[model samples]
Target: MRIVQEFTKGFWKELPPFKLVLGLCPTLGVTTTCYAGIGMGLATTFVLVCSNILVSSLRSVIPSKVRIAAYVVIIASFVVMVEMATQAWVFPLYKGLGVFIP
Candidate 1:
């Protein structure tokens, strides 16, 4: 129950893009099509998850001064890999999402 509650909390309370408006540009742009919206949301979620795991693992190694740069590099690399993979294998989805790939 607690686990479900914790997960459910995000449904209305802690939506990263909607509540905080963190990724409004992509949210707004991608939402024009339902497929694009889902694609963008999943992509963002993947990046967030990967970055969170990397940062948590490297928290001790990353200095407070340079953590931001390290995080950006990690996130950018994941985004590039996702973009390339999608372009190569899911060409139709990639074409549909064109400029928004990255």
Candidate 2:
């Protein structure tokens, strides 16, 4: 079905940090070990999904003039929150990611 195709597309067709060619630098930079790689991948996925949901929900309410800035703010907030949570709960990963996040 079309829905399933759209959902599964990322697994291979548009696989992130590879075929898509977006944010590949961080993917390679932070992934020194398998555990670190998985942690970074999940964090990236979470931030993207959260930002998408927030932007889509606010699309109607936001003015076109500042839409880009608004999305940046939303994405930045999510990233910061994730970073703090990782720092507090998963100090090892926080350390592993090192300067890559900033």
Flag regions of model 1 displaced more than 4 Å.
1-19
lDDT of 1: 0.80
Give lDDT tens digits, candidate 2, residues 1-102. Answer: 998898789666776556556566677877789988998899899999999999999999999999999999999999999899999999999999988766
TM-score of each: 0.71, 0.78
After superposition, candidate 2 runs with Cα above 4 Å error: 1-19
C-alpha lDDT of all candidate models, in order: 0.80, 0.88
Model 2: residue 52 alpha-carbon error in angstroms: 0.2
TM-score of candidate 2 relative to the true fold? 0.78
C-alpha RMSD by candidate, in order: 8.1, 7.6
